[model samples]
Target: MTNDAVLHTEGLTRRFGGLVANNNIAIQIHRGQLHAVLGPNGAGKSTMINLLSGDLRPSTGHIFFDGQDISGFSADRRSRMGIGRSYQKTNIFPTFTVFENCRLAAQSREPHPARIFSNALSYRTVCEAAERAIELAGLAHRAQRHANTLSHGEQRQLEVAMVLATSPNVLLLDEPLAGMGAEESARMVELLQRITPDHGILLVEHDMDAVFAVAKVVTVMVNGEVLESGSPEQIRGSAQVQVAYLGAEDEHHG
Candidate 1:
């Protein structure tokens, strides 16, 4: 495990009865880099993210966060410990203004449960965090707009803002570009490029173009095991990756 890694998994394995979800895998996500995990269906990408976020415990192996062993921690605990995640589905309060949703997420990180019921606008610290997060996600102009009123792409950015509100050191983003069009995808790619310079990002995405554009390293998985890992150029040219994941598209064009 690398000492500089904010999130590291060692020999991580998980099983359900007789079925293995994640095999013996060791991966590192260093600070200030975006590491992307790409694989076909049933390749254990979701399982790996679940394990890292502490949603599911590893049947075998260990998870570390910020140099601390946190395999035993729960999902909420991991979030508080600077490990945050965004789901494929939009996760924001539909009725609330964009700022309000981000404010709530930021308030949750303060360790004061009573504040949950308090008027959110009263907290200066939380407001500042929300502003910073919204700005980071490129939604600062829409902060006052109701979440439901925004387009799907803006909603997705709001979800990312919510994750940022928690001030996490590592971000696990699952298919953030899942439903985006070309323009939205381009915006998201830009947002990722800006944020990854300071935080470690573990992205699970099917958009090979965006992944190749923003990721510093790419890890390819096949049937719950790592098949190859290297720079974008290397992954783009790997025969194994082309067969297992990228298919014949690259070969046809190359």
Candidate 2:
């Protein structure tokens, strides 16, 4: 593993009965880098993310986080260990104020639960963390508004803020730009770039433009295995990638 790697996997494989979903997938997420994973449907991209997030145990392999082998850790355990994840769906509480949603996320990191009689927001640390996260996500102005009132783009940003509240060093984001219009997609791309310097990000996205714009490295998968992994420039120039993924899209449009 690289010294700066915040998370890495070695020979990660997952099987479901007779089917192999992910095969010998070894990837690395280093600090201050954005690694984007691209694959056709059924390429096992989601499975790889699930395995890294501890949502599913790998059939064979190892996951290391911050230099510790945590393959056996549960999802909750991984979250507490500074691995934060955002789903493909928006997971915020609709009725809560934006601030409240982030505050609750920050509160989850409290080592000791506050007394039941005490107010949840009265915890200074949690409140401050929440405030910082909202600002980082560019939602400070909307902090007092209810979550349901925000646009779809803002809601997605809120979810990321909630994850940020957990103080994670690694962020696993699944298709954050899904369903966004051109403007929303641009903002989301900007947000991803802004946050990349501070976290090791593993982004699974279908938007080729956004991925190429923000990813420091790109890994392409096909038929449950990696076809190529390289910088955006290298990926764009690869004949293998074009034949397997990129050119297929072009041919379809043609």
**Candidate 1 clashing pairs, residues 3+ apart or interchain:** none
Show where candidate 1 strays beyond 4 Å: 114-118, 248-254
lDDT per residue (tens digit) for residues 33-75 in model 1: 9999998878899889989998899999998887889999999
Instruction: Write candidate 2's Cα lDDT for 167-201 as tens digits.
Output: 88899998878877687678778878988999999
Candidate lDDT values, in order: 0.89, 0.91
TM-score (C-alpha) between model 1 and the true structure:
0.91
Residue 162 accuracy (lDDT) in model 1: 93
lDDT of 2: 0.91
Model 2 spans > 4 angstroms off: 1-4
The most accurate candidate by lDDT is 2
